[model samples]
Target: MRLLLVEDDEHVAAALLAVLKRHGFTAGLARNGAEAIEKTQAGGFDVVLLDLGLPDADGFEVYGQIRRLSRIPVIMVTARADVRSRIHGLNLGADDYVVKPYDTGELLARIHAVSRRAALDQASSDGPASGGTGGAPAPGGQVLTAGPVTVELSTRRVLVDGARVELTRKEFDLLALLAQRPGVVFRREQIISDVWRTSWEGTGRTLEVHVASLRSKLRRPELVETVRGVGYRLAVPPAL
Candidate 1:
């Protein structure tokens, strides 16, 4: 897979480039936010590893620019580890974030996880024909029925045992992604990209935060199961 690495520190960039190359990734380097945005738009990279501190522009500004043009997955690599910075990055549509001095193994794992999730989402989007006028019943109209909960994609609505359940846009999107393939695990990075349409800016907690909000509104909170060390999946209840 091709990846864009944006960092001003020469040593850091060199080290990461070698590591990413060793992992069979075609890595592109950018020294500043402006170059990062430019290279990103010009190249078809599978993912982007961006640094928040850039000489030309703030990392957030670069993120905003990239998000405006493409939905390419992004992973933020920054020295800032504070909660506020992380949350702000996420709010601006970053997919994941990795603090400086991070382990190479962890970063590689994150990249693979995000990539896999992207592939799954693309498959789902391109799978069977979903939208069409009245005709034979469409299989894409399959409603995920989980006990008291029912999600209807055709109507973009959710109901708990027949009663409508109010949800924010992000919450609804997250639920729909999970309900699309019950029991299939989705990493936090995948959830953020597929549901939020943002690159991974290194904030996996965003998934937990949103999931907590979703569970609070769900009739059966247990329907969404946390798959320790992986991500989350919709639980399949016992047959009646």
Candidate 2:
């Protein structure tokens, strides 16, 4: 898989590049966050190894920007080994977090794992079935309605109580997933795996955040009900 190594340390970057080459993987180097973002925006890279300490911008900032700019997976390869930093990075949507002095084999394994997951996610999105459930898209522009809310699957739009409700891509996916089987509780792990398509354990909080955002955006706090340590389900069961 192609990788972008975003480390300012030349010695570290050079050594990692050699290792990557020996593994038959192509990689490009970015000395700072700006270069990393630029290279990422230019596309072609499959994954990114970001170091936190960048000259022009914080690696976290670059990471957030990259996620917003594209769906490419990013892994944090930094010396910030603190639990807080790891959680923070993962919560910000990183595919994986690898500390400094990580085993070369493990790093390569993580790279492959994230790439594979990304491929699966892309395939699912482009396949005949839409969203996490793998259900075929409804013909004639299917729409799901639950109480005051409505979801337009083909157009990726939502309306609540006859008013339009805007949603982010992730938010829309989460909503559509729950809408697939309203009143059928979806485990948090299932939600994370389906929406984010990564096995990283730190993404549970992201799931919670998205659920909450969906509630707020849909303008009905009780529209998505928490199942108390289990998961969430649409408050109103489906009719069609």
Candidate 3:
């Protein structure tokens, strides 16, 4: 996923950026509020990690500007952990808030959470005009085949080795999104946004749960390959 890390602390930003990159995310750094706003205006960002402490302007102000500019998901990553600050950020439309000195794992989760939500909201606004659920292929519209897995989009039906495999709404959406582009690694953010219709970081666990369920239901553990440290891809077994 593409991310804009808006932070002023060079050391902190550098460390976080390195870790984010190692985890397979493309991230850009903006040292101040102005830079953050400027970079966002350039577009192509999936989420913004905003630090409230900026030299030029208040983080809140920057956030407000960003909200006015675009609906991009923004997570407030700052040291302001007070109740009012958190409440205010939310009131200004911050998707999520994370206090400083937080576990990196948790921060990443929050980022994913907000992004997922934004994706879902975007899809909802599009109102099926995007021809898919949460940006997934429209049901009853087409059939996607990968190896022994056959996904009937129009019917939301799945058949493995010619036997029907019932799936939940999310399960079907997730599988269909992967099947649409077999062998390609779909980032967790993308999957959550497209399938769950939300880029919520917390949804990661839910996605994992759904994946496990899908594998069990399909009786094909190898059907969805996990790309370690990245995301997931469909593993279509070679023809026998």
Per-residue alpha-carbon lDDT of model 3 for 72-186, expressed as tens digits?
8999988887999899999988888899889886676676556655654554454444333442444332667888888766556688898878899989888877786577676
Model 1 TM-score is 0.55
- The pairs that clash in candidate 2 are none
- The numbered model that scores best in lDDT is 3
Cα RMSD for predicted model 3: 6.5
Q: Summarize candidate 2's per-residue lDDT along 16-54 as a digit string, tens digits.
A: 999988755779999998898899999999889889989
- Give me the runs in candidate 1 sitting further than 4 Å from their true place: 129-240
The model with the greater lDDT, 1 or 3, is 3
Scored against the true structure, residue 158 in model 2 reaches a CA lDDT of 77
- Backbone clash numbers for all candidates listed: 11, 0, 15
Ranked by TM-score, the better of candidates 2 and 3 is 3
Question: Model 2 misses residue 115 by how many Å?
Answer: 0.3
Candidates sorted by lDDT, best first: 3, 2, 1
lDDT of 1 by residue, 160-230 (tens): 76777889887887887777556667666667766766666865767788899998888678988998986
- The predictions' CA RMSDs to the true structure, in order, are 10.7, 14.0, 6.5
